[model samples]
Structure formats: C-alpha cells, structure tokens
Target chain A: MLKNIQEWVMVFLIIGAIILIGNWVGYDILPTAAIPGILTLIAICLLGLIIHRLLPFKLPSIAYIGILGFVLTIPGVPGSTYIVQWTNEVTLLAITTPILAYAGISIGGSWADFAKLGWKTIVVGMCVLIGTFMGSAIIAEIVLRFQGII
Target chain B: MAQQLQRLWKDWRLHTLVLAIVLLTEMIGTHEVSIGPGLILLLPMLYAVIIGIALFFTPLVNEKQTKHAEQLVFLSVTLLIAKFGVQAGPALPKLIAAGPALLLQEFGNLGTIFLALPVAILLGLKRETIGMTHSIGREANIALISDKYGFASPEGRGVMAMYIFGTVFGAIFMGLISGFLSSVTPMHPLSFAMATGIGSGSMAAAGLGPLVAAFPDMSEEIIAFSGASNLASTVTGLYMSIFIALPLTEKMYGWFRGKKDKNPTKIPSRNQRRCYKLC
Candidate 1:
C-alpha cells in the first residue's frame, strides 16, 4: 500500500509538471498560479487512494477518488471554496493530453498481439466499442428527452 | 518504498517522450476538418495519441518504454478522474436534477451486448462472443471472465483479444466518433457527455474533448455531466456486469449461436485488481 502511494505520488508529480507546462502554453495559465491547484488535486487524489487502501471491503479506488473530489469541492464544506478555486485553473484538456499520449505510445507493443486476434476479432472489437458508447448515448438522449430535461 | 521509487525513476525516457508529445500537440492546438455532413475534430490529445502510435512503431522507441507507458496511463489516469470529480462538485445539483437519466444511462451500457453479440455471432464468433461483447472488455470484465472460465479457455482468449484492441483503438475511435456524432446527430451535447462515461478513462476523455470544443458555452456543464456519469458507471459497473451484462450475454450467445442448452455454468466471485486499462 505504501509502495503504491509512493508510486502514484511520483507519477502525479511527473504528470503534474507536464500538465503545468501544457496549462501555461495552451491556456496561458502560469505554472506559479496553478501549482497550488495541482497540489490540491494531487493531495486529494492520494488521500482517496489511502482511504481506499485502509478500507476493509473492496471497491475501486476511482470510486473513492471521485467521491473525495466531489466532497471536497462542494459548497458549504470547509475549504471547499478554495479547493474549487484552486483546481479551477487547471485546464481539463491539459491533463488528458499526456494520458492519451500514453494510450497511443502503448499501442505498438500490443500491435503484434492485436494482429494475432484475426479479422473477425477486429470487427467484433469495433462493434463493442461503438455499441458501448452509441448505445448509452442513444439511451441517454431518449431518456433525457422523455424526462423533458434536454 | 525507496526501491519502488527507484523503479519509478527508470521510466524517464517514456515520460520525456510523452512530455514532448503533449507540448508539440498543444502548440498545434484544435482543428476541424469537414467531411460530408460531419467533421473530424482534431484536438491536442487526439494528435498526442496519433503521434505516439506513429512514434511507437519506429525504432526511436523500445519495448520496455512501451510497457512503462502503458503502466503510467493506468497509474496517472486517476488524476484526470480526480479533476473531473472536482469539476463536477459544485454542479452537483445538475447531476442530481438529471438523476434518473444518469441512472438509466447505465443500462445503456448493455447496448454493447445487444448490438455486438448478434454481429459477433454472425461474423462466426463462438463462445468467445460472450466474453468479447460483454461490458467493453475492460479490466473488470477480464477478471470476471478469467474467474469464471480461466484465462486458458477460449472465452479468456476472446476477452484478452478485445481488451488489447480496445486499449489500442478505443480512445482514438471514440474521440472521433463522439466528435462526429455530436456534430451530425443533433443530440444535445450533454447526451454525448453521458455517453462518454462508458467506463474507460482515456476513451471518455477523448470522447468529451470535441463536444466541449464545439460547444464552448456548455463546456463546464458538459465536463461536469461526463464526470458524474463516469463516477456512476464506476460505482455500478461491477454489479451490473455480474448480474446483468455477463449472464445476459451468455444467454444471448447461446440463442444467437442456435444452441439448445441454456445452462452452461455458474459465476464465481470475481478477483479484481487495480486495473483501469482496457488492455
């Protein structure tokens, strides 16, 4: 658990540096201004991980992290205003660029394995990916329209 | 802890390449190229992945670097989700107001099996169809299949294949498709946002990018809705997989394959690890 905490903190710091630069270049948000926001995001994320590790039962660490973020930034909560204000400076796009980059970088290693799966597998894989997203979107649209929410 | 820190430091080459990719792509910024009725919206993250794939095949990158890149995505994506969660916090009222739609949208995830299962069978897939078409073949789905059928089985092979395929292409395809769909379909951007929560981190981010780009006015709401729906999916997905997705796919697979016996096997308790990767 401790090792994972260390690893995640280190990776976040690395990615955080990359994100700070991306924020500055892309959004014109200076790194000096975004540093506290990035740190708060990092600290809350690690706290969520630590909380999940300490829990007796099993649940995804994402559940914990998402909940922590939601709780920490909600209104009337102590420090919630500052939490929201600080994290507000970090552009969402800046954070996701490296993630998709890693996603892309990892693809070639699996290209060999992917080729072994055959054409039928390719067709089915695309189907599931499309179905998963389009299906949900179609349903959400229908339900939201039905509920008069959209 | 010190030893693990040393191991983390060894991925420097991977991080440097990723940093370079991010900076260059951001410098190029957002673009939209129209084809027919739809547009292929190209964002920085989209280019980052494309360039990364292009670079990976070249001798400039190595196998070990690729492995570390994959590991780093799983480790670091939590931060992205953290950002989304924080963004969604104050907009809690919007998420709560549209609560039923958010909850109902989860059942939309089953559309994977509904749409993919018949096609998978028609394309001549066998029992493997059950594993591949079920739940987009993410880390949890892999564990469920491995627990029930063992990784050595045909079903295990099916899930693993789909997992690799999703990891490789799901982000790029999803980003493109979501962008295209948002532009051409005329559905509200929020609908596309809910759809983005289909249980993968990088893919969800990819899908959300273009919508927020096209509809800058609703960018905050779009980001918040995607974040909330994604959190909803993560919380409910495991139970939904076991009780609904897995079994339903199995039943449908039998019917689609024209098999007589309905009862094949019972499910085992799934052994899940910290896996956010479709790979």
Candidate 2:
C-alpha cells in the first residue's frame, strides 16, 4: 500500500490540475467529466480483471450499486417544478439518514466492543464528537461574555 | 471475495437493524406530531450524521473482514455529502463566505488527534492504527484500492485506474444532475456541480455547467419541475451508485477465476501497527 501511495498522489494531483485548467477554460467541464470518469473507472477495473483473469460473470455488489447510483442521477427534463421539489426532498433525506444511521450503528457497535475496554472507547468517541462541539460552544460563549457580544 | 461478501452480509444486517430501529423510533416519536417541512427534511440529514459516526467507529475487527465495509463507508459518506450539499443550497453564499473559516475549523479537527492519542493508548490499537484513522489521504488510498482489490491481491495500478475513473464519472453525473435540476427551479447549477464534485469528486462534477446551460428554457414554473427532477436524480443517484458497486463487484468476482481462500487473510487489528504514507 505504501509503495502505491505515490500513484494515488499523482492521480489526485492530476485531478487538481484538471480543475485548475477547467477554471481557466471557464467551461463546466468539471461536472461533465463525472460520466467519463465513472465509465473509465469501470472499464479499467474490468480491464484489469480481464488481464488478471478475474472478471466474473456477475459483478461485485459495489459495482452494481455504482451503476445504480449513476442511473439514479440521470438528468430529468430540463425544467420541471415537480422534479426540483421532489429532488430537494429526496436529497435532504438521502444526505441525512444514512450518515447518521451509519454513525449510530458504527458507534453503537463500537460501544459493544467498548465493553471489552470497559467503556473507554465509547467515552472517547462520544467525547470527540459531542464533547468537541460542546466545548467549542462553551468557549465561544465565554469569549462572547468577555467581549459583551452575547 | 467470499470474505468481502461475508463482511458485507454482516454490515447489511447491522445497517438494516439500526435503520429499522430508527424508522420505528421516527414513527412512534412523530405519530402525534405534524412536523414542519424544515424539520421533516432535517430528520434524514441528522440521521445520516449519527449513522455516519456509527459506521466510522465500527471497527474492522481485522483488515480483510469485509472489504466492502470500506466502500460502504465511502458510499455512506458520499450520501451525507450529497444530502448536505443540496440542503445547504440555500446557504451557499454564507458557506462560501465562511469557507475560509470552515477550512480552518476543519484543520482544528486536529482536536480529535488528542482524543486519539489517549484512546489509542488505552484501547491498545497501536499508535499507527490510530494515526492512519486520522489521515485522509491514507484513508482515500485504502478506500480506493480496497474497493477494487481485496486483501488477497491488491492491484494498485488497477485500483488507481478505477479511482480516477470513478471520480470523473461521479463528477459528471453530479454536474448533469445539478444542471438539469437548476434549469427548472431556482437552484444553482454550481451548487449541484460542487455537491457532485464533493460527493463523487471534482473531476466529474466540473463539466456540469455547460450541460445545464444547454437545457431548453421552460417558463420559470416549468423549470421548477426540472429542478425537482435534478435533485432527485442527484440524491438517488449517489445512493444507487453505492448499492450498484457492491453487488456488481461481487458478481464480477464470481465470474472471474479466483477461488475463495478457505482461510482468507485476517483483518488488520485496530491497534495493529502499519506504515502509512503522509505524502
């Protein structure tokens, strides 16, 4: 993995470079690349599999999800009120529930594992999130109080 | 591949179980109430954050336990980004204005570093494991690779190619969706494009403006419909992408000639030390 880090870095750099060039070109080329990039990734991965003789009849579940996600993202009619409102509503739910759910479950599971450490992991993770926010708020309040900004 | 499948199965059960509980809670909690639209929409976003934390902390148990776990995490996070990116649409000016400060605050998450220092010592997950957790680039690299190649035989060149591919497509998909939605409604293509970039990455979302600009004009009201559709497509698209990747990868694996290792490699322990690249 360490040996490959440089390659990853180069990829990111290329991405950044592309962004810079796009900015100069001032075209919406950035988002347009999503389709090409996704297709390319799938193609390359498939190609790699083929080379390695690892291409199975059925694709991995993740690959399926990626395809589904791409399909779901297809553009609707250029202008439709119903589409906008619905997407807004859906976007809200999509953004919120899964992440919180993931956190809740992952944390909850960690808490289960935390038992082996006798509550320490739970305490720490909780504090890092909850505590940091609370601490920041409190400090903000204190500074506000001193400055009479509250 | 079976090892990844087994891990995914475990996560699915876990995810389902948790979501079920959340759904039940929402029903029971909201039954007596007629919530406002703002609050109603807020529920999922908040839920995502909560779940994201859960997923983040859910330990790997071992390195190869579920190769899919990492992908799921990425998908979950991507979803969160999409959700917030769209919702935050109304607040674009403010967020951009505060972008610098926000960036600083992001840096200040280094506070979590202190938390890690002590917890890692206490939990016995070596300093290295804890360190890796904090490193975004490392996490990205791991995520990009693991999604394609399992622990048995990670093809770095292959994974890199895919990451580049995924990033670009995700961006375009997001851009198109954003542009499409913005055409019909008051929503901005830039926001959607940015969200797409963030959700998928910049390379893909960067191309959205022209696609959006090219759409036929409808009366503003009709354009609103397009906006709604765009929003749905973007959000749903992100979710579907995640689901698609997992099953497709598994299917592809099955079709390929690799035999399932009866005794696959063990997952790396949380505290286990491993070299991480900073650059």
Specify the highest-TM-score model's number: 1
lDDT of 1 by residue, B80-176 (tens): 8898888888888888888888899899999999888899878877778888988888899899999987887678888998898888888988888
**lDDT, residue B57, model 2:** 46
Where does model 1 exceed 4 Å of error? A1-7, B1-5, B259-279
Report the CAPRI category for model 1: medium
- lDDT per residue for candidate 2 within B117-167, as digits (tens), equals 345345543322231222111224345445534322323332332332222
Give the per-residue Cα lDDT of candidate 1 at A49. 80
Question: Model 1 has how many clashing residue pairs?
Answer: 0
User: Candidate 2 on A1-150: residue-level lDDT in tens?
Assistant: 332333323332332232223222332233343333323332332333233334454433233333333333334423323322433323122222333343344333333333443343333443333222222223323433454422
Report how far off residue A34 is in candidate 2 (Å).
25
TM-score for predicted model 2 compared with the true structure: 0.33
Leading candidate by lDDT: 1
Per model, kept true contacts as a fraction are: 0.77, 0.14
